[model samples]
Target: MELVSEHVANWTGVRLFQQALRAAGGHRFPALPAALPDANGGSLPADRAAVVLAELDAFAGTARITDEVELIDEATGRVLMQYVESYRGVFMFGPGFQAGVHPEGFFVLDRADPPVTLFRAARFGQRALPGDRVEFTVGGTRTVVAMRPVGEHGEPPPERLAVRTRSRSGGDFAYVVEPLRRLCAASVATGNPVMWC
Candidate 1:
């Protein structure tokens, strides 16, 4: 993410005033510079001024609060819990990808045969941040298997297991079939080549 110093001048001015107050032998108190616009017209409300003073008193350079959570590991089926203080952004992958967020972290899996690609869904709502480790239940019960490919030689070869040949009026169209084992034979055409080892 790009960092823009939108409020840097304002914050710097506040810090300078606080420093001057400390150097003046007075109790260190936060002071608003005259240039800063008051939340209430030209004057700050008593309650708002008090809150600002309290915030300055409590400010200890560069301190921030953080929170923790749990995530899961898809490969080992392990549960990993960790802290995630902020949401940076998300990494996007194309559609139909199934991924899980565990205490170990978030990861996309390749359920297709030969594991075509490791991808994360484009829209996974409020799941987890990049660094956060969380635990989640694996959804969807269906399992896919690898189908042997019939090669041009009419033999199933291991190397050709991912390759399928289809006969068309335009001649033969060759395609590398996705490895989804549970699909019925009717779903696949016979002339389609499967190079099975």
Candidate 2:
């Protein structure tokens, strides 16, 4: 059987393929890489769920993968590799794979860009902003693993706080501003890095 389109339109393979391809060399097809384990049992590394998709702009003989790329035919249960046209050049799905060919860590999602929901935020019915970096897990079909924001360290966003500046005598200091208060509103100090009150 042949699919005229060269694009493998699925998420299962794209997330896994890119990783293996990069590590194993560009031309060499990589065996599916195992998903790294996280707190939620085991899921794809939240940091590396790259949606490698491009517009099907003016091109030929290569179709862009909009979502996931699968190796097996769901109906026939046969491994498949379809060559189709895409924006990035020839995109081949597979030469047909075995049942167990699926690589671990391939998290399936309904949409390419999953909603950003930190464990803490999800509890409050809040999602991450469009540009906020988030990671997640996929528990089942079209299931989303509530995303976990990444690259975040040290106390959550700052609020009200009290501080004291170093003072010796009754000095007529022009102003005193606490740098630790990230939310503190202060004007720039005339000569010092200190924010003038």
Candidate 3:
């Protein structure tokens, strides 16, 4: 999930790349990076070992090429349809849409027994950021929700919610406070506890 150097990897991602290359016509490209040899230099190095990272760095340029790419099943060599790439780095198949390419809408259902859901935001045109309370009604499939802003010093925030502290950093452990019975816990670092107490 994390991108680290193949040379420093506990297991080489080179194996995956090699498999992908084989599926993409290995010898056709001619710029494939050579795999690192083992101590015996007889075969491809172990998959569970770090690889020579420079070898991988060498392939970056060629991999970006928009050559006719098809994801094929290795065992059967069956080319999977709808997994084709038309232009460089753009997918014309699969879900037909890429994530994070467009902004995502988020929802938080507070004061309600259930939680908020957003199958599609355009259904309601709801706009909300994190730490925001939205009041909305759920449609049959796509939920329609709206944010209910809290009045500062005028009224309490929506139930089951508390005012965030100055620092939004996490603590060592995670716990929840009761909306009705919660206590104010503000710890100040001072030499004399009695002074602030």
Candidate 4:
């Protein structure tokens, strides 16, 4: 399915969050895996589903407390659970967990039969500011440039932008890179053009 959003999104995280959205609205996502490993080195098929569902309900209720979702560490056979304060509709899953959606900045993905992927380090000659963004397009044969903010420069950034900046400044650049990397990898794996704007 084509996932459309005006904000930055992780491919898998967005899909999972979409499922949670549906579940929070009183619908179950049967597409969820039939089973997920638990911290006890034992699989908890039923409990996993229950925990996810319950958490969705709680999220919908705007509850402050988050119950632990028993999931096993993929690399280490240990329990992993934690809560992250959400910002800009982005709910960051705790460490070692890969199931949360973050919406920040903006990028549009245009699908192409065979996408072109490019990776290059930013070349800064001392003029590059922290707020400067690198414009990139993933799938298209042509370049795309985004327009600057319409308002005056002194104005504060939008809340979403502020949150995103905080996230990046807090050494969470990996969170942003991980999603983009996943998108690029997906394009490479599927032989499809993944456009970014």
Candidate 1 lDDT over residue span 49-90, tens digit each: 444334333432213311222242333323232222222111
What is the lDDT of every predicted structure here? Answer: 0.27, 0.22, 0.26, 0.30
1-197 per-residue lDDT for model 3 (tens digits): 21121231111223324434454454543333343221222322232112322223333324332222232223333322111111222222112222110112222322334522233221122223355433433344333233333222354332221111111111100121111001111111111111100
Off by over 4 Å in 2: 1-3, 26-197
Which residue segments of model 4 deviate by more than 4 Å? 1-44, 63-197
Which scores better on TM-score, 1 or 4?
1
Residue-level lDDT of model 2, residues 1-197, one tens digit each, is: 21111222234334333432343343332212232221223322212222111111111112331232223322333323221112111221212211111122122122224422112111111123444422332232122233332212342311111111121211111011011111111111111121111
Clashes per model (N, Cα, C within 3 A):
30, 18, 4, 3
> RMSD of each candidate?
28.9, 27.2, 23.4, 19.8
Per-residue lDDT tens digits for candidate 4, residues 81-173, read 221323222232222221221232222222234522222111101111244322333333323222222111464322111112111111222
Q: Which runs in model 1 stand beyond 4 Å of their true positions?
A: 1-5, 8-53, 56-93, 97-103, 109-197
Provide the global lDDT of candidate 1 against the true structure.
0.27
lDDT of 3 at 36: 26
Indicate the residue-level lDDT of 128 in model 2.
Answer: 36
Q: What is the TM-score of each candidate against the true structure?
A: 0.19, 0.15, 0.19, 0.18
> How many clashing residue pairs are found in candidate 2?
18
